[model samples]
Target: MDLWLTLAVMAGAVFLFVTEKLRVDVVALLVAVSLLVLGVVTLPEALSGFSNQATVMVAAMFVLSGALQRNGALIAVGDLLARIRWKWLFLLVMMSLVAGVAAFVNNTATVAVFLPLVLAATTANRWAPSKFLIPLSYISQAAGVCTLIGTSTNLLVDSMAREADAVGFTLFEFAPLGIVFVGICMVYLMTVGRLLLPDRGVPGSATADHIGRYVAELLVAEGAAVIGRQRSEVLPDGSNDVTVLEILRNGAAVRGDDVRVEAGDRLLLRGLWQDIDATRKSMKLKFDHVARDLDGDLNAERLHVEAMVAPGSHLIGHTLAGMRFGHTYRARVHGLHRRQLGIRQPLDQVPLHVGDVLLLDAPVKAIADLRIDRGLIVMGSRAQRKVDTTKATLSAIVMAAAIAAAALGWMSIVASALLGCVALVVLRLLDPDEAYEAIDWRVILLLAGIIPLGIALQKTGGAVLAADQLINLVGHYGPTATLAAIYLMTSTLTEFMSNNASAVLLVPIAIATADSLGVDPKPFLIAVAFAASTSFATPISYQTNTMVYTAGNYRFSDFVKIGMPLNIIFLITATLLIPRFFPF
Candidate 1:
């Protein structure tokens, strides 16, 4: 009954994760709670994940990465990349730089910091951003597997291995095979992968210009020239770029070319920003201000900027009007850009999702506020912040020291990371609030919530039961083939779900399979770790991929065409090399 319960809960969790009906963290929490209630795990075991070393270290690393980002340590490198003129050289240097940075910092942050810089460089060189953005995301994942601290999945697998009484990996243990993977990825991307990438966006156009068309609601104010004009007369087809999709009278949709525009009527229009603006001026229409009175001091100098809703942001499901976005951020959302989706609803009523780029109009001072908000990644040229060179140097040194301490076995990774975070706060490099905000609570919660499911599987013998089925299917091919199977399964699952969740769910099974086969579990554990950390088949497979999806103006099939081949290559490489490094 306990084994059945554990399997049932795991199945349900995977379904929820893939469907995305609920957030990944929420699904994980449900899995943990379900396991506890089903008697598959004790209360201590159920809650143990929250206090796990991997969870703690992941949170601490976020703070350290934040310190580096805030102090200009990361941006300084981006500034140097902006000078490269040759396209090929820029691609080479950009990939190399991003990979190296990602090996130490969080992969998502690495991509986020360099995204604007890459866009700016590609625009200046007239290169298609789609050609380089996917590589940037893919290489970051490849590099992340090079170090244990490089990705949260690595730490989670290591901690799980230690708990199972197997020898865990060192900080650099993954580097040998990981570096080989990175080299293969770089070569493949430069040669074949380049051909697969779509040449999206117009040459020499600004990133904002490539955001595609948007849907906006415009009000026909009193005394507007179009007040008495027929709908066809105002937005005549083929006369201009703008098209009126629908007309709303007193909040109800009204259809027909015979309908005359009224002073209070709202027009749902679709067009480019320039065309939209031009239409508004010519038709004497105004933006339907959801929060009209919130726009304080309209005379102040305002700046137009693009900002992306970051992954794990608190604003994902809320509407602009519901959140009173203009009042909260003191910025009016002019338009929204979503990849390959035409938003037909009112702008303020549309719920924000990850990677949705918002066109914001705000006062000059509010730009800083937008930059500081963790929920938004302000696109394009970053506003210059006062950088303290001394603090920047110290922050780098502190981060290096923490990594060295963990690598040298001076302290456990969790302790070293905690100490480093304290040093940053003590040195005034990061405030306590900033440190707290730096940790992506969504990811932390996901990790803390899902880990116990692994415990439940192991305790209930569910892992062994699953391992028996895998063994019956592939164990006859010997340990090498079984190892290959494990890698393939993990890689495939990761492409569709949370990589960490995939790892947590599979690592225990790998251990059980190895134990049943009478071989070392280290190689199997390593397979799970590497496979889980390097998802490349879909933009939604990893956070870094999603970050670049809209910014690069890519279609869903764009990732499929370019990333599927890379995923297979990585699978083949890991299967061939992991054994040589760890010897099954």
Candidate 2:
């Protein structure tokens, strides 16, 4: 009865998490607490996961990755996208490189670094960022599945493999299958599917002149002229050029056009640059001129410092108001370069989040002083000369060399990565304190919380029982069906949850099922890893996908329109390719 109940509870938790009814962190904690309280896990066993070596390794990697990112050691190879002569070939080459790099780094972090650059490239090359962003995100995820240290999934699978056999996965164990699969994907994405991608409503943006900046507000005064108006109706005299971006009334994230312009509801608008003065005059709109140059007032007396929101900063959650930037740091909140969602949004109203590159144009004197200050790590701004290029190159080389060493079995990926981190610090690529902020606790907690549940499932004989049922259902049709089923299930789960968690859950099942069938487990394991990592569907599906989704100013439907077909294509290919390569 306890076993059945436990299975039921676990299934329910996964379902709830997939449906997003409860927050993931909260769900993870609930599962951990329930296990401890019910005695399925003793206090030590339950708590032990938090301090697990795998969890620490994953966390440490983030900080090390951050060190490289803050110092600009990592440049988006997507910047080289302009080199491609053909558009389709360009998309393919870009995605391939991004995915390949993602295999060694966090895909989300990889996409975050590239989002601005991709946006800039699209503007430079007369292409839509929406098309490249999602593709790049998906590629990075796919690439991450290529190496043991590429993603947390590889790490989780390695840990599970060690427990199963004395010979665990080496770093390059995945390279053979990964290279083949990724190669096929690259060719297909470049040749066939690139033409199918949507050209979203984005235009070229070389200079500031390319952007539309207008000041129009929802007039909330009593008996105001623009009350109870639709988006089109609120616009001035049917020009169709002006737009109402948002209505901030009473601190709510609402989507309403006829929101009844009550008192205190702030309005946001965008329009043509030349018409801006006339429109503001005609509508009698009052808007703060945010695009004004920082050369005057306040900046002349002080230093102007710029910092990209380094990974794992204390500044992630708090707003400028809550952070007391003016009160504590003696740094005035000046300009910002924030991606409110994916593309650039007005920084004035932006609720600050992690990885936001803030253009802190302050006084010139304080600029150099702010460079190594505790919180804000300076990334070279537009006018700022590329500082310490030699150190940056050295840091990048160190990271790459460490990866190469780990992959070749000179040291554990964890040890190699940590050594690389130490080298980065020693070389002064990233400050010791700044490195600490780069670790994402949420992802680490998710890993720590879910690992024990996988163990519990194993202890309860759940994996074998599940395998037996799967065999009964699909074994007669043969192992091909079984592998396909496993791939599909793993892929669907990865799309809905974290790829690492999905890989962890499916690895035991795949190995168990393979043992039952008397076939090679490597192919099945590879299928699980690959399928779970290639999430091209929704922004919410993966971290990297989310990074680009907002930065490109993309609609939710855009990913579906772009990735759904690509996913189908990959799914069909995996079904055929897995058996041919490894023989299920």
Candidate 3:
């Protein structure tokens, strides 16, 4: 009866989590508290999860990731992407590279780094962000399959498995399935998926709704004043927004701007419209009005252009009317995408951020002058403002040392990462307030609340009972068949429950299955490990996917159309791959 009651309460909590009725963190904690009040678990056992090493490790990783991003460590890698002559091959290789990195880092960070990169890459080629942005986000989620530390859900499962059966998955146990799954995905994305991907960014946005319009490329004519000037000095007021989005020399796109601009070089300047014209009129520069004309009708001839609020862009959490962007930049207010649904209103009142694309209209001459200020991206071009990286060396060194120490096990991964955060503070690499703002407290709270409930389930013997049920259902078959059964079950559940919560629930069942078979638990455990982490069947399965769903302006069928096949691929790979690895 006690076990049944425990299961019923947990079922209710999961139902709430799956249906999105209550916040996940709230539901997780509610279950833990209910266990105590209903006598399902003792207070001490329920609360013990707060101190679990796994929770601390996950929390610490979040902070470290923020530190790295805040210190500009991840963005610095932007230089590594080489120019590709073939767009198809370029997209494939870039996807592989992004996936490889995500194999180690968190998925959200992967998206964070690559989202803007995709936007810049495609927009430069005159393709809409839609062609690659959704794919990038999708592939980044798939990257979690590559390794143990890649996703928090995986870590949570490993931790839970260890407690349940005194065993857990090995570091590379996922590689066989993951590599094959990623391989098929790569081929699909490069070919069929690419064709299926929408060829444009979202439209019908308010002034700031369309992002492509925000980025632009300009040409430096002969005898320009900035020809001999470095970015720091040429930047108006030394403001950070000024970015040299891209450079064209002799018809070739150059990623580096440190090279002095020569006569006839096409310059992609990411700045305000006012500065663009100021430079063109003041320095005798010209606009790539041809490029600008593609995304939207911006006639430098007529003196008008467009721009948007980018993801992680300084635009998020700020109102345009409050900041008086029009008054300060001398550009006319236009349409905004504004948060859709219940939050739908004009962008003039909406706060902007990294995923939002906005549309703006202003004088052609003013657009030309505004192009030099870095905080903005010209709608159709990829340009970066010159940053003073001389100080970046200190921040970089601190980050590297932290990673090395953690990887070498000289200190705990979380502790080493925290040390890097302190180093950033001492060096003043980023504002302390900025660092705090970057942490996603909602995710942190969700992880914290869910972890304790997992402890309760384990302590009350509910996990064992659940596992016994699964074993009895499938134990009649061989271990391999049982493994597939478990994988399928977890995958189906994850389509509704969160990947993290699902992992927590399924680990015990995996252990019980292993016990029933009297085999080395690694095989069954590996199946659970992989299954709980991959949820491509639905958009709501993972929070990261949900973020992309809204930003991409996609429908439920979009995920069903693209992600359903990916899920099928993962299931087959797991059923086949885990057995070969752990050898049940």
Q: In lDDT terms, how accurate is model 3?
A: 0.62
Better of 1 and 3 by TM-score: 1
| Tens digits of lDDT, candidate 2, 1-584 | 54675587688778877876665656777777777777776787677667766787787678666766666665535447646656676776677667766777777677766655566556656666656766677677767877877777777766765665432667777776677667766765565556655555454343222122323333344455556665456556754475566665655534655555554455565555435445545655454333344335642575444455543456765676665555444455434434332322333445565435453436665565555453444533222224466766776788788888776778887788888888877877777876776777777877788777776666677778878888999888888888888888887887787676677678778888988999878777777777777877766677676556545555567777667777777777777777776665
Candidate 1 residues 1-584, lDDT tens each?
88888888999999998877788888989988988888888899988989998999999999999998878787677777779888678888988998899999999888877887787677666777888899999999999999999999999999998998557888898899889988999999989987788877643365436365666688989998877888677774443678877778876778776888888998888777778878888777887766667667878898778888986577888999899899889888877777544566667778888888888878888888887676888766555466779989999999999999998999987899999999999999999998987888888989999999999889889889889999999999999999999999999999889999999989999999999999999889989998898888788888888888877777788888888888888878878888899987
Of the two candidates 1 and 2, the one with more favorable lDDT, higher being better, is 1
Per-model root-mean-square deviation over C-alphas: 3.6, 6.2, 15.1
Rank order (by lDDT, best first):
1, 2, 3
Please give the distance, in angstroms, between residue 186's alpha carbon in candidate 3 and its true position after superposition.
1.6
Give the Cα lDDT of each candidate. 0.85, 0.64, 0.62
User: In model 2, which regions exceed 4 Å deviation?
Assistant: 21-23, 76-89, 164-167, 204-219, 226-321, 324-387, 518-520, 577-584
Per-residue lDDT of candidate 3, residues 1-584 (tens digit): 66777778878988898776666767877877787788867777677556655565565555555555544555545544435546676677678777876776677766665655555565454445565655676677677877666777776777776666666555555666677767877887787777776643433323223332233345666677667665444435543353555456665665444776677776655544444545556656665333232333433444334444433345556777678776556665433332222222333555554344444556555565455443344544434434446445666577568767866768865577677777776777656775665555545556656665666666667767776777777777778778888888888888888777777777766776677678877777677667777676676776556555544555567777777777777778777777776787
Worst 10 residues of 3 by lDDT: 205-214
Cα displacement (Å) at residue 185, model 1: 1.2
- For candidate 1, the clash count comes to 0
Off by over 4 Å in 3: 76-85, 168-177, 200-415, 418-435
At residue 504, candidate 2 shows an lDDT of: 65
